[model samples]
Target: MRLAHGLDINHPVHKAMVELGKRLEEKSNGQLIVKLYPSGQLGAERECLELLQIGSLDITKVSAAVLENFVSDYKVLSIPYLFRDRQHSYDFYDSTIGKDLLHKGGDYRLMGLCYYDAGSRSFYTKTKAIGSPDDLEGLKIRVQKSHMAVAMVNQLGGAPTPISWGELYTALQQGVVDGAENNLPSFFTSKHYEVCKYYSFDEHTAVPDILLIGTERWSRLNERERQWLQEAADESAIIQRELWRKAEEEALKTIKKAGVKVNYPDKHPFSEKTRAIMNMFKGDSIAQKLIRNIKSMN
Candidate 1:
């Protein structure tokens, strides 16, 4: 099987994928092989997903934010303040709701294998520290292409600018966008900390990365092969979560050493500011139900 993703080889997610390949090979006794192309060697997340739809790619990892484009149900995962904390997020992923969201992409030719910890996303800025929603006023925030992300930023009083991850560094350098939101590991690994000197832990969202296989490719596998692959994926997710926790800790320490100012702002105001984001989906019964279900988990 061929797997591709846009993350750098040093990323915890990439390391998890490596573990997945190793485990898969061991379980299948060399009958199954996984060829990985990291660092966007094959294409970006969306392109890789498209490849999966056509069976050109066997598997890929994409943010739930991106997956929402194909599977609208995933938009629930992008809602700000959706999960109470890391444990809440994990509980959601392991719950029936999360599992249902994972398989929702089957109609679109994608079969989600498991979730990987991408961590909670927070704001990192260049010129000013975002201590509250008022601080975000008049600022342009770079967001993912997902509508939910744009809506959250807008609701929080910042102008949301959707920019591809590959172009974000230059966008920040050239002042194309004032700041961006991402997890600590990404802020450190992407070197965005160099430009965005302020790291605020508002922890607005805990969107996870979804590991997906092409439905066509999945159907081609024998039952035993499918079992081996699923088991490998499940185990890799556990490994990735531990790796992500350590990475977040190290990223905070390293960014501080690099002179980035980190702050843990009271999250209530940020959460209150973005609460309107939920009502934006009131017309969508499915999304509203998801919101209620997720909140009930907390």
Candidate 2:
């Protein structure tokens, strides 16, 4: 059996997937294999999801933020200051609630497999270091294609500009936006550091990259094949998490050598600024209950 997986090869997680294919082939005695479409050869993350819906793609990796539009329950992960830290985020995924969130996309024809570590996102600016929430005033900040992200920026007093990932470097270089938020590894890989020099480690959101199979394609696999694929994905996640940690450390080191100014501003002010945004969830009983549950976790 041959499976096609889509992801940007430049990403470390892609390396783990390649290792997964190798392990899967060996475990199945060369009966199963995976082919990867790197560099968005298939298309952007959203386009890839559409392909999955139409039964034109087999498996793809996407951020939870991108998957939120397809799975409403995923929006809960985007709430600022939701997870206390990195370990907390990892622990949540290992919980039943996390497993529940993965399966929540079944209605959208998505069968969740496992989560790959994507690291926490933070803000980096071109002209100045953000030392306080007040410093974000009037600055044009680029956000991902998620409403929650835009709302967070707005609550912090910055103008939220939604720019696609591929266009962000140019957007910052040409003065289209003053800054953007993303993981440290992305800042180095996308070469956004070349344009944006100051990085403030506010560490707002921790969104995991999801690996999934389309239910359309999943239905065709035999029981043995399904078991093998699931085992391979679970093992690959362990590999991906370790690589992500090393890559983050390397990325921070590389960018700092390239003349970037890094800072650890008082995050309390930023947290206070986004409290109103979190309160919106309290307005609805369903969302309020979910929020309490997330906060209750270890």
Candidate 3:
């Protein structure tokens, strides 16, 4: 059977996907093969999902935030500061709610296989330090095109510019965007830290990179093949978490050496500013229920 794997090259998700493919091949004894297409070679996240809808692409890695556009229930993970800490995030992902969120995308033809930690997103600016919400005011900040992210930036009083990741460095260097937010590894690996001098560890959002397989493809697999693939993906997630932690540490070291002023800002003010945005979804009982569940978790 022909299987296509879609991902953006240089992304941590792609690194994990490559390892997962290798493991699946070994477990299947080469009977079930996977074709890897990185660097958005197949298509962007939305395009890949469109392909999945029509049964073209077999597998892909999509952000839970992006998934929210199609599967509104997936937006729960996009809520900033919803998790107490990394352990809280991981523990919740292993709970019933996590499983429900993963499967919720199936109604839209995307089936989540596992969650890959993307780490906490923090602000990095080229010429300023975002030590507090007031520091962010009037600054043109770049955020993922998610409504929640854009709203969070707005709540901080900054202009939320939705720029693609590939174009962000140029956007910053050219002064199109004053700053951008992401985890340490991404900021370092993308070399955005080179242009951005200040690294504020506000730990705004802890969105997980979700690995998904098209329901069309999954349904075509035999029970044994499905089990083998699932086990391989699960094992790869374990390996990816270990790799992510090491990457985060290395990124921090590299950025400091590059002259980035690393500051640990008090997140209390930041959280306070964005708290009211949650009210926008109050009418959605499911989302409200998720907020309650997350708050109650340890």
Most lDDT-accurate candidate: 1
Better of 1 and 2 by TM-score: 1
**Per-residue lDDT over 1-298 for candidate 1, one digit per residue giving the tens place of the 0 to 100 score:** 9999988888999999999999999999999999999988988889999999999999999999999999999988998888878899899888998888888998999999999999999999998788899999999999988999999998899999998888899999999999999999988888999899999999999999999999999999999999999999999999999999999999999999999999999999998988888777878998888888988995
Q: What's the distance in Å from true for residue 166, model 1? A: 0.9
Q: Point out the worst 10-residue segment of candidate 3 by lDDT.
A: 1-10
Model 2 poorest ten-residue lDDT run: 1-10
Which regions of candidate 1 are displaced past 4 Å? none
User: Model 2 off-target regions past 4 Å?
Assistant: 1-8, 283-286
lDDT of 1 at 139: 94
Task: Write one digit per residue (lDDT tens) for candidate 3, span 95-153.
Answer: 89887788887778889888888899999998888889999989999988688888889
Residue 66 CA error for candidate 3 (Å)? 1.1
lDDT of each: 0.93, 0.84, 0.84
lDDT of 2 at 138: 99
| Count of residue pairs whose backbone atoms collide, per candidate | 0, 0, 1
Model 1 per-residue lDDT at 20: 99
Instruction: Give the per-residue Cα lDDT of candidate 3 at 236.
Output: 86
**Which 10 consecutive positions of candidate 1 have the poorest summed lDDT?**
274-283
